[model samples]
Target: MELRRRYHAKAQPGQRLPDDVWTTDALGVLSSGSKRDRVNAELFRAIAAYRQVVAKFKMGDMAGNALHRIGVIYTEYLKDPDKGFQAYQELLAHYPGTKEAVNALYKVGAYYLEKKQFAQAVKSYRQFVYNYPNDKRVQDGMLAVARCHMETKAYDKALDAYQSYLSKHPDGKHAAFAKAQVAWIRTYHY
Candidate 1:
């Protein structure tokens, strides 16, 4: 409620526009307007509710779920990717043992990857691989690291990562692609 008001109806001069007109969804983060106000009002109330659950809760999974929803509400619905990303970070940091934490790891990596921040993406993916060694996505994360390297033309590093993946899982899901990348690097980038 407070955060929503600050960002929406009660927005300051800097936050609001010259005309101060906007259209939005429920959270008021989408745009700005009367209908926007109605929608944002509802959305803001939801965030307030989620926050309450998170603040006064002991159920790890429930708390984790609330945090995850907060992240989604901010990122996906409110159009605040940074805050949403922060929420995901908080979820992982506070609830490392939760399933939401696992998903947050991937979401964090994918967010960076989508921004073409290959190095950061690699770092995030590496965290996913290291933290959840036996996760089903470990191989995918490994391949993603290699692909990020390749995307940045770090052929040598890419080849190394690819080879590492192939060595770890000879017939894993990405084995064929890893082998192909390794061979391609050797053929051209060598």
Candidate 2:
């Protein structure tokens, strides 16, 4: 009862608190001079609460934005790659048609690339290309697919992807880079 009162009292007019605020505030409390055990307990509780929210909600861009924030926070601050990947994947699955989805797909692909998950990177980049064919990033996605294939030692597939990009976009902004990559790959093959 006291906790609810304190929480509600802090609410400003016309500003509704997000459900996660409870867990966040609890963490703040635990971190502020609380015992180590208390802090750990609060952290576990927060994780469980967040997981429940993630599971229960049918996410849109709003939730996707939240998930993106969670992913970045976990990846950068918490150093939890698995949780971060899960958050990103949730954004992709729940908000596939949103602007956030396009951005998330790119981010997930980049994440896979950084982790040297070349096949996963290609899969993500391909999906991005298929979904946003006319987007400015479409060319970049195509280029990334080729780069991922190249990194995974699939030289022929990389050449095909790069060649396709060059042919489709002769004067594109990334055309020179695509052509250069194709030339480099061809030289290596020869």
Best by lDDT: 1
TM-score of each: 0.71, 0.67
Candidate 2 structure quality by residue, lDDT tens digits, 1-190: 3444554676545656677766665656644544655654655565566666666765424566667767766676567777788888988877777676777788789889989999999999999998888888888899999999888888999999999898888898999888888889888785
Q: Rate the local accuracy (lDDT) of all candidates.
A: 0.82, 0.77
Q: What is the alpha-carbon lDDT of model 2 when measured against the actual structure? A: 0.77
Query: For candidate 1, lDDT tens digit of each residue in 1-190?
Result: 4555555796544454443343343435444446555665677778888889898885557889998898888878888878788889989888989988988888899788888999999999999999999888899899889989989999989988998998899999878878887888999977
For candidate 1, the TM-score is: 0.71
Looking at candidate 2, what is the lDDT of residue 154? 89
Instruction: Give the residue spans of candidate 1 off by over 4 A.
Output: 1-43, 76-80
